[model samples]
Target chain A: MRTLAQVVSWLALAGTLAPSLFYLAGGTTLAAVKTWMLVCTVVWFVTVPFWMDRAEKD
Target chain B: MAEAPPSSAAEPVNEYEREPVPEKARLGFKSFIGQYAGEHTAGTELMIGPLFVASGVAAFDLLAGLLVGNLLAVLSWTLLTAPIATRARLTLYFQLEKICGRKLVTLYNLANGVMFCFLAGSMVTVSATAVGVWFHFPMPGLNDFFPNSIGWVIAVLAVGVMVAIVAAYGYNIVARIANYAAPWMTIVFIAFGLVGLREFLNATQTTLNSGADLWRLCETAIWKGGTPLPGQVKFTFWHVTFFAWFCNMAMHIGMSDLSVFRYARKSWYGVATASGMFLGHYVAWVAASILYALQLLRTPGNTDVLPGPLADGAAGVAGLICVIVAGWTTANPTIYRAGLAFQAVFPRSSRYKVTLVTGLIVAVFGMFPAVAMKLLDFVALYGLILMPMGAVIFVDFFLFPKLGLTSFYAERTGGSFNVAAAIAWFATLGIATWLVQAGYTQIYFVSLPGWFIAAGLYVIVSKLHQRLAP
Candidate 1:
């Protein structure tokens, strides 16, 4: 039940944010936006292992 | 979502490489690139570009939006999907099984596999057009759902058989075909771009000019900024932007490619995806659109999007063949993935037999042209349907601890189909569907936020129900 509520809230957030990002970022700076996205991706990739806790058997 | 597999001094937890997991093998960087490029440079481009033209995206919206959107797509794969894939060492299905349980995973696998098949079938449809051009078969019309001519039917069957055979052979075969095809096919894609530029020059009867002139051409000719075809959605810069970004939402945000990237030596291997983003999605998409826009200009009556005709007009028979094979490269692995998903359903079943069966299923669906005909909506719906489980997997992997729940809780708890995951998946869908159906917003635009929604929900649900991973 808690999971369900969390999912709902996230979707709501996504709805609010994704489109807003398109607008706020000023879709006009296509190259800059691409660079920004690429940087985000690079950071995400490099650090994911550090942040994630792996699965373990009981 | 399975709790970390118990470890002793003899075995240490593998970080990014595959270790401590039986039957899981880590892959090098090149394989990851082959997989990404091969997957994204789909046969569907022939279909997608024309449809965009049909929708009448203005030149700037289509051009500028794709430039921005595709980069976002590439980033999503690099950032959101790759890191987990390199770290997890499991297929999205297997990892989810650990989190959501076998029953829930089975449902997701079915959806994932089916979506892959439909996607493959469209490629088959694209390839068949080349056969129609080469072999003199009567091609199906855009509105033609069923195989209109005996020749078209034969061509599709022949293409389908080849695709199925290759798919059944396994990943080595799939990767090899993609690798072999990528280089040559990429050249052909570039040629398509150059030819489009040449044709545009001829049409405008003007020498190449400064940026403003090109922008004007985009507004006037390329995007032409028109309403969509009879049943298609209107694509403004926003629609084009999101569509370009989310076209591969299932693979990136949905985490389906976790199966393919688990082999990477480092997550940064994902940067190679730019090869496909630029080569196939960016260059090819724009080039193909130029070709189609040219077609609409030359003969306004020809609404048919068969690549053969478009390619023939752009660069003779060679372009036609490129369109066909481009579809094959993309579709081949997609069918293979679907087969793998189906394989999970009957664990004892051989992948070869499952792929063969799944290929036949898609081919049969191909018989009705509608599957390929309405590809835009099909792809969006495809991503939407499969995405929730992907979200469940991501959250189960990354966010569970933050929620004070054990990751991979299902495997640890000995549950089949984690109840919290199962409920979260459906509940997110139900609500998202409600928003779309009630006209709150469009479906194509939903995936980005929808992904976060499902991910957050999975964790919260895991906490509320105390469902224990099982």
Candidate 2:
């Protein structure tokens, strides 16, 4: 469970980073990038707490 | 109020720096949400929002850039800073001391504490401007470096002393005041935009009959994006985005908030930063910008960004009070943080004494208008100065072990200074400073590359240093 949680945490970070890098590089139009950013943020936010709980459960 | 932890000869009554935060003392997500929202939506927003206008950022760039950048900031807090905080559960100073040794951490503490003093001082200046409104004092203009009137100095001293005394008591008072003020200040900030929108509609004689009309009005009247006023940097989309992301680099990427987040029950509770990033940075900044944009439209000649008169124009006495309280709430915690940083240096001293001294230093700095007037550049520079150390922390924490080098080498080896950490910090700073001086990039762009530089340097230097160690 801890190993899985660590992997999930790493993947969540990557998911968040991808859209941000895209935005920095001007990869898409404003609306598309904005929507993607919002989605990425939600995904990262939701996933982290679950990962944290699973990892920290003693 | 939370009482001091019990003291013993072995385990003292101090906030335990060398140990993990006990489960009993760990706070929940709501606590973090409240603190971040209150701290971020503050006097600085009033100053920063106007700076975006002064630098001539367009509506789309300013709005979109903030949305993207603030999200990045939130993620940084969540991923980079909070994970370390929860795992280590030590103050930044204590963590650094373990990794970088006592001597290096002391230097870092001095730098951090001094920067906090200047930052808190700027807030005192903000609150003093509102007081200046009441006293009918000749407030400092945009270019004015020194106090313009005796009333200005007296008001600053009074506000500074009050903020100092409160901070000396500790963050419980600061947090309480901030929680009470956050909701009300959030409303006033919203009102600032609504009232400004009404005035803009009236003055321009344009009705927001449609979404297109509102967009059109936003383009024409608000954030038109042209030549910045003389002496201000021209802001592009990248500039706005980077500034928004890096503005609090000291706290997020620089890992200063390792102390704040260390109290969290779980690392992912860092998602709570969204409250501050969105409400304070996004909403308050836009509202304050709207106030400045209105002033620009009304009197193009007066480009001086004064939050006091601007707030008074929007909501009269309520706006003035909001400005005053916003500055207070912001400065109080900052002074407290500065006190903690100073207390780390003088571990034997009580926090109250250190905090009182920290407040006085801030008050002295508050006497200088330049610090407040040039707040934008000052913030950017401040973040840059402290950021390399954050990179050092990140590298030392995660990457060192992966690279076949021990983590917390200073602690394990019982060394006084880690040469690798020092090189990573100074070398990254040197290269970044050179880049800015050589006109290759602005301060905002350099930190992103600088982080990588520091991270890489730490790894390579650590490999060499460990190999050479007897």
Candidate 3:
């Protein structure tokens, strides 16, 4: 569970960073990044509490 | 009739005012990332982004300046604030009491609490703009200061009550809201940009055939570098960079985030701030700027900068929802912090009661539309007022022992108010205010110098005060 949450964290970071970098690099459209961001955001939200609970055990 | 009780009479929960955070309670890095992202990419972005366009910033300056300035902000968090927070694991007020003494820290808490209420009020105003859009209430203009309609007032009150209830529930609720809202807000902000971009391109008949064309459109239509809008300052690259960097100086360099980061398992968790800097300040800001630019394009004479109408015009009902949620997520935590500041002064008071009262005060302030209209200046002023104490903390924590001066001098001597800390805080503000008022330097530039001034004053005065002590 901890490992999975860590993976989700990285994926969440990537989801946020990619679109921002894409826009900065002059990508005018966000068609592709939107779907990617949505999935990552939902997954991150679900997994975070599990990780937080895991921290409790440690 | 029964006699009223004193303001400090109530009891508090989670008042961990005198101790370090327990090991089992520490949070992982990802928690900070979620909180920062949600807090920073908020309702203010809608207003602030538009103001940047109004200030006449060019694309290169806005973009490059934000990159550099935000990087500096992240470094300040990672290197300056997080280390001390993880070491001490105390709230900013407790830490201040140890260094500045209880009496002085109470005064600082008063100022901090009041400032936070006003800031949260501005967020309430942002949310109210969306409500105004839905009900077709008369909203304030860019230059308006007071609520123009009863509907606007009612809307603000409703939003304020909901935000207050959530805040009074405590940090877990606030964090949960942020985590849930952040991803959605990010997507909505991106959508706002896309819709605005398409609208602008269609309206102007500009084809995005090449990068050069997009750049040309950005320069001409979006952030046309020229004279600022009426009653605003012209913003250059340096202004954008410095403003972005110092806008949250209180939290980072001022060490207020000690409360937030103290829960972190590692100081390097401070890097989590990057999520907010990039996503909210960078992307959301640019998106909102695009929306405002489109507004200017459609109706050259209409200069109103209301976020609700701007966003609703861009993304309709979804945009309105974003404004409210963004405001709530941001203001919930903010009002919570304000309550903590006030509660620190009245340590026996219930945090929930204090938070409710703080939210009410914020709502009252929110009715005065000027707080939201002039948000850029207000945020800068907030940081300036709070930052000197941060400087004192920075120096006392890191530089004091190097100079053979004892740290936490107030605690060490059992003094109520450290004269050296008071002098540093007041003197720095006095000089910075004078510099701005006397036309020596602008507000954005004064803080950097004031930081150094405060640090130097603290070291010298602390040394003198220590030697002169009985």
**Judged by TM-score, which candidate is best?**
3
lDDT of candidate 3 at residue B376, scale 0 to 100: 75
Model 2 clash pairs? none
True contacts kept of each: 0.00, 0.00, 0.04
Residue B147, model 3: lDDT of: 85
Can you rank all candidates by lDDT, best first?
3, 2, 1
lDDT of 3 by residue, B71-157 (tens): 988899999999999998888878999999999998998988888888888888898999888789888888888888899889888
The runs of at least 3 residues in candidate 2 whose Cα sits more than 4 Å from the true structure, single-residue gaps closed, are A1-58, B1-14, B348-350
RMSD of 2: 11.8
- TM-score attained by chain A of model 2: 0.54
Q: What is the TM-score of chain B in candidate 1?
A: 0.89
How many collisions per candidate? 35, 0, 1
Q: Pick the candidate with the highest DockQ.
A: 3
Better of 1 and 3 by DockQ: 3
iRMS (Å) per candidate: 15.2, 14.0, 5.6
lDDT of 2 at B4: 5
lDDT of 2 by residue, B249-281 (tens): 888899977877888889999899888788878
TM-score versus the correct structure, for each prediction: 0.80, 0.84, 0.87
Among incorrect, acceptable, medium and high, the docking class of model 2 is incorrect
Candidate 1 CAPRI category: incorrect
